[model samples]
Target chain A: MSGVSEHVVIVGAGQGGLQAAMSLRTEGFTGRISLIGEEPGLPYQRPPLSKAYLKTGAADALTLRPAAFFEKHDITLVTGTRVDSIVRDTGHVLLGSKTLGYDHLILATGTRNLRPPIDGLEHALDLRTLEDAKRLRKELDRPRTCAVIGAGFIGLEFAAVARALGHKVTVAEAAQRPMARAVSSPIAARFAEMHLQMGTRLCFGQAVKEVDETGIHLPDGEKIDADLILLAAGVRPNVELAQAAGLPCDNGIVTDAQLQTADPAISALGDCAVFPDPRTGRLVRLESVQAATDHARTIAKRITHGTATPYAAVPWFWSDQSDLKLQIAGLAFPEDDCIECENGSVLRFDGDALTAAETINNPKVHMKARKILALQAPPGRDTLKRAGYDLTLI
Target chain B: MVKVTYIAHDGTETTLDGAEGDSVMATAISAGLDGIVGECGGSMMCATCHCYVDDAWSDRTGPRKDGEDDMLDCAADDVKDTSRLSCQIKLTAELDGLVVHLPSSQL
Candidate 1:
C-alpha cells in the first residue's frame, strides 16, 4: 500500500459508480478503474426517467456521461455485466465465470424497485431503469387510463405527466396522504389538491388487494379500471452479492463513515449503502443524486489523498410534478415537528434542532437550509423566530 | 409583452421583457440571470428557481398548485406569504409589473 494501487473495481455503473470512477481519476489516482452494471448501454441518470424522459421520450438526454468520457478517463465500463460474487480474501470479484482482481473494491450496485406481492404485477410498469421508463413512455402514446399504485415522488411525477398528456390518472396511496413518508402532512395534502385539480384521481388509505387487466382492486372492494398501472411504491437495495459474500447488510449494505464495509477491502455507496446520518446518527439509505455523488467524492478522497474524514454531506432532494417543484434540504423523521411560515415554507425540527426544511419552487430557502444545517452552530428555533425566520441572517 | 423585475438576495434588481405565457423562471433564465438554476428545466422537478413575489403584485400571480405548495413546504428558508415557484408563475398581461425576490441559497 506504499504506492497507489493500480487496479480499482467498482460495481453498479449508475450515478455513484460512474462518479467513483471519474472522481478517482480526478483525485489523481492513475489506476485501472472498472465499472460494471447489469443494465444495458451506458450509465444514465435515473431522475428524469419518471419525469421529463417519460413526457418527451428523449432517451439521449438521460445518459450520465458519454462513452467517450469513459474511454478518455481510462475507465473500463463493463455494461450489461453483473458481479456474481466477491472474494474478500483474494481481493477479487467474480463476474459471471471470470474473476477480476482489484487493489480496492467499490460496491455501487444501487437499488431496484420493490414490487409487492400482488396478482398481475407483471401488468404494472416500473419506472426505475431506462427500459422500464421507455416501456412506460410507449404506453403513454395511447389514450388510456393510468393507475399509479404509490403516491411517492416517482408515482406522483408520472401521474402528473400522464395527466398532462390527457390520460386519465388515478393515484392510490396506502398512507393517509401523498408522500407521507417523505414530506409533512400539510405538504402532502397540498399536493393531493394539486393532483385532484389536474383531474388526477386520488385514492388514499386504500390497499391494493389485487392487480388485473381490468384494473386494481382495493381492500374495500372498489375496482378502478386502468389500461396502464405503475408500481411506484418504493425500492430495495441491491445487496444480494454483498449478503452472499458474507458482508454485513441491513436494509442496505452497511458501511462505516468512510463507506467501507466490515471488510476493509470492500466499500459501498449510492442507494445501496446504508451509513450513519451525521445529523441524527441514525443509519439511513438515501436515493438522491446528491448523496451518490457526494459519497463517491468522499470515497475517492479517502482512497487517493488518504483523507479519512467521515462522510458528513448535508442531504437534499427534489421532485417535479406538473407545475410544482419540491425541494427538501436535510432529513426529517416522521415525528419531527413542522412549523409553517407565512410564505408556506415548512421548518421541521427534531427537538430544538432543525432537522429539515421543505420548500416548493423556492430554491433560495432550500439552499439556505442546506447551508444552515452545514454550519457549526445553526440558528435555533428561537433565533429563527426572532429573525422573522428569514434564514438569511442565520 | 409582460414586464418582470427580479430582485436578488443582495437587492440587485434586473428587469426583463417576457413573452406572454412564459414562466418567470424561463424568463429569468433566458435573460441570463446568474441565479435560478432551474435544474428540472421548469417541470417543477427541482426547486432551483424559487422566488418571492412582491407583496403588491402577489395577487396578480395565480394561487400555487397543490404540488407547488407541497414543494414549498421543504424549502431551505422559512416560507413566506409571498414565496412562489418562479416556474409556476407564468407571464401574463395582468402580471406586467410582477416583481420577485430571490432566496439566499439554491444549493
Candidate 2:
C-alpha cells in the first residue's frame, strides 16, 4: 500500500493480462509480474481471428509480443498452465499442488463459447481462441457448405469470409435481424443485405434444433446440408475459478468502478468483468479489445501509482465483413431512439442524451463519436439534430 | 531481410530486422519496440500503429493506403504529412533501410 505493490499475479494472459503486465512496468512498478495463460503460446489478438487470420492463415499476425519481449520486460510468462483455484485468504493461487503468492491478482479469464443443448452440438466448431481459428482455417481448405448458427458478430464475420472463399454459407438466427443485440435495426438490415448479396443464405427467425451428420436442422423440419457446422451463438464468462474462491459471480465476475473485486487484493477485467457502464450506471460485461486494454491500464495504475480514479473509458467496437467495416462508438440500450445521419451513419439517443453512434466504412465519424462520447457531458440528441447529426460540425 | 530503424519521441532508437514481406509495424511489434501499439493487429481498424516515415524515405513509402488517413484521426498523436500506418508499409528488398519515427504514445 506504500510504494509499488510487489508480486502482481495476472491470471488469463490474453489481451488484458498481457496489458496489465506491460502497463505496470510503464507505470514504473518494478515488481515481480507473472502472467498465466492456459493457451500454449504468447498472448495474441483475438479480433482478427474471425476476420483476417481465417483468410490469410497468418498466425504471426495475431501474436501480441514475441518470446524475447517477455524476457526483456521481466514479466514471467507462463503458458499452457492453468491455475486450479484461488486461495483468497492466503493471497495465493493454486495450480494443482503448486501455489503462487501475489500482492494483487487480476482475473482476465475471458469467456468460452456457449454450447446449447442441441444434440450432436459437439460436432460444431468454435471461433474463440487462436486454436479455434486455426481449425476453422483448416476447414476452409475445401469448398464446402457451412452452417453458421447465431447471427452475432462472430457468426456473421465467419459467414462473410466463408462466402467469399466460394463456400456455401447458410446463417441461421433465432432473431428477426442479424446483430440484433449490438446494432440498431437499420445497421443490422444493411449487414443482412450485404451478406445476402454475397450469396450467404440468411435464415431469420429460425432456431437450429440439432446438428447431425447431415448438418443442422430447423425446428420446422428443414435440413441444410452443411459439411462445416460453426457455433458462434455467443459466450459465457469464465467465472468458475473466481466463483470457487468465494467471489460473487453474476453474468460475469462482479467488480466495482475501479475493477476491484470484493477483496481489494483481487481484481477482474475484460470479457470476464461485469462492471458498471460509465455512462448509464448499468452492470455490463463487454467483450472487446478496448475494454480489455483500458481495464488493464486502470488496474495497473491502481497497483503501481495507487490512483483511485474510476475506470471510465469510452466503449467502442468494430466488425469487418468482406469489404464493409462497421464501427460503433459508445453503448446503446435496446430502448434507445435511433436516428439516421446524413452521411449514412446512425445515432442512438436515450431520450435527449446521445447514447451511441454507428457507422459503416467510416472511421472518421467513429473516431469523432468516441471523442464526443468521452466528454464530461456528451452532446444531446437535440444538439446533434440541430447539427444535422454531423459529428464534424459539433 | 529488410532492416528498420524506429526512433521514439524521446530520441530512443530501436533497430530491428524484418522479413521481406513483413510490415514495418509487424517488425517493430515483434521486437517489442515501445512506440507502435498496433492494437488492431494490422487489421487497419484502429490507427494505434501510426508512425511518421523519415523525411528522406517518405516518397519510397509512398502514399497512404486507401482509408488509412481516415483512421489516423483517432491516433493518439497528431498526424504528420508523412503519417503512415506502419502496418500498411510492407518491407521489400528495394527499401531495406527504412527509418520511421514513433509518436509519444499509443492508446
Candidate 3:
C-alpha cells in the first residue's frame, strides 16, 4: 500500500472537484479537504441546467448536496474564490492574499463556454454555469424567439426546451450535421430530423459573422431575426492555471492514465484533463459527468486508498431533447463506421472493433452496451453482427 | 410531512421526514444518506436509486412504470419483484409510513 496524504486541496469546486473531496472521505481518508471554487453558492451538476432545470425551473434540483453536507463531511468548501497560481516547488496554491499548502492538489477547473469571434457577441447568453442558467431561466419567463449558435448537445437541448416552452427557435451550426464530433452519423441525422419536426429552424453549415440586436448574420449575407441568442458553440478547457504552472497543455492539460501530472503532486480530471483512453489508448478529454465523477473516484482512490489503478470507467452520456432521451455508451471517433440496427439503435465500430453504442429512448440497451464494452476483449464487428447487433443477446 | 424509513443493505435503518412533493431518492440525497447515489438526479435516465419497497407497501406503490423496469436493469444491485427506482416514487400522504430497503451497492 502507498501512503495517505495529509491535506488534499481541490481547485474549481465543480462536480469533479467536489466529487474528489467526497470520495476521499468516503474512502476513509483522515486528511483535510479544501474545495475552492471560483463560483459562489454551492456546487451543482450542469446536465440538468439544460434539460429539467430549463423546463421546470427547479434550481434546487440541480444542487449535488445541501450546504450542511460540507460541514457534516468535514470538507472546507471555499466559494467565490479563485486559485491565483500554483507554486509547484513549494506545493502551495495562491488565492489572492492567502497561501494554502497541500500534500495533493487536484485540478477540476472544467471548461468555459467558447466565444467565437463575432461582432456584438456579448448579446448572446450562456448556459454553462448556474449563474448563466439562472439568467437564461429568467429570460425564458417570457416567450422569445431564440437563435442558438451551435447544434451540439447543449445547443439542441436548449432549442428543445425553448421550443417546448412555445418559443420560436433557430439553430445555426457550422458543421454539416449536429454533434458531429461526438456521435455517429445516423444518430446525428435522427436529432436533425427531430429538431426540424419540433418546428425549430435548423441551419446547417451556416457560419455566423456577427451577432447584433437584430440577431445573427450568416456568412452568406442572410440573417435570422431573434430577440434572444444563446452561445452554445462548445467550450474551451480552463488550462491557464495548469499551463501557467508549467504543466503540459494541448487541447487540455495532459495527464497520465492515472490522471497524475508530471509534477506528481498535482492531478487533473473532468473537462480540463486529456488522458489516455483506456480502450483505444488515444488521448481524449471528455466533458461529461461520468468522466468527472469517475476521474474523481480514481484520484481519490489513488490518494486515500493507496490504489494505483488507471482510470477506466466506461464513458456514458445522456441528453433529454423533447420526448427523445438519447444515451450513448463508450467513445466513438469521428471517422468510425456507424450501423443503424433494425431496432432503432446505432452501433459504432472502429474497423472490426465495436467502439460505441447509441440508443434513443432505450435505457436497457445503453446499460447493456456499457457492460459489454467494459470487458477486456470487447466483441468485434463480426461477432456483433452474428449476435444481430443486440447488446442484450451479447 | 411523511415519515420514511430507509433500510441499508446491512440492515441499518434510518427514518427521515419527507415532504409530500419530494421524492424518496431526493429526500435521501438531501440528507446526505449513503446507499443511494441518485447519479442522474431523478431523471429516468439512470437507475442508481434502486430500492425494494416493503411487501406491505408494494401493492400500494404498484408496479414499475412503463420504462422503469428497463432502467432498473442498469442498477448495480439485483432487481426483485418489489424493485423500483426510488425517484419514480413521489411521497404523498398515503405513503407517509413507507419503508424502502436499499441494495448493497448503487455503484
TM-score of 2: 0.98
Cα deviation in Å at residue B33, candidate 1? 23
TM-score per candidate, in order? 0.80, 0.98, 0.97
Q: What's model 3's TM-score?
A: 0.97
Best by lDDT: 2
Model 3 misplaced regions, further than 4 Å: none
Give the C-alpha miss distance for residue A97 in model 3, angstroms: 0.3
Q: Score the docking of each candidate (DockQ).
A: 0.06, 0.70, 0.61
Report the lDDT tens digits of candidate 2 across residue range A1-394: 3456789999999999999999999898898999999999899999989998898999987789999989998999999999999988889999878899999999999999999889999889999999899988998999999999999999999999999999999999989999999999999999999999999999999889999876999988899999999999999999999999999989999999999998898999999999999887899999999899999999998999887799899898999999899999999999999999889899999998888999998877888898899899887877888899999789
Would candidate 3 be rated incorrect, acceptable, medium or high by CAPRI criteria?
medium
Better of 1 and 2 by DockQ: 2
lDDT tens readout by residue for model 2, B1-107: 89899999999888888999899999989888888888878767688899999999999999998779878877889898999999999999877888999988876
Which prediction has the highest DockQ against the true structure?
2
Off by over 4 Å in 1: A1-3, B1-107
What's the lDDT for residue A117 in model 3? 89
Q: Candidates' interface RMSDs, in order?
A: 9.1, 1.5, 1.7
Off by over 4 Å in 2: A1-3
Instruction: Please give the distance, in angstroms, between residue B66's alpha carbon in candidate 2 and its true position after superposition.
Output: 3.4
- At residue A218, candidate 1 shows an lDDT of 93
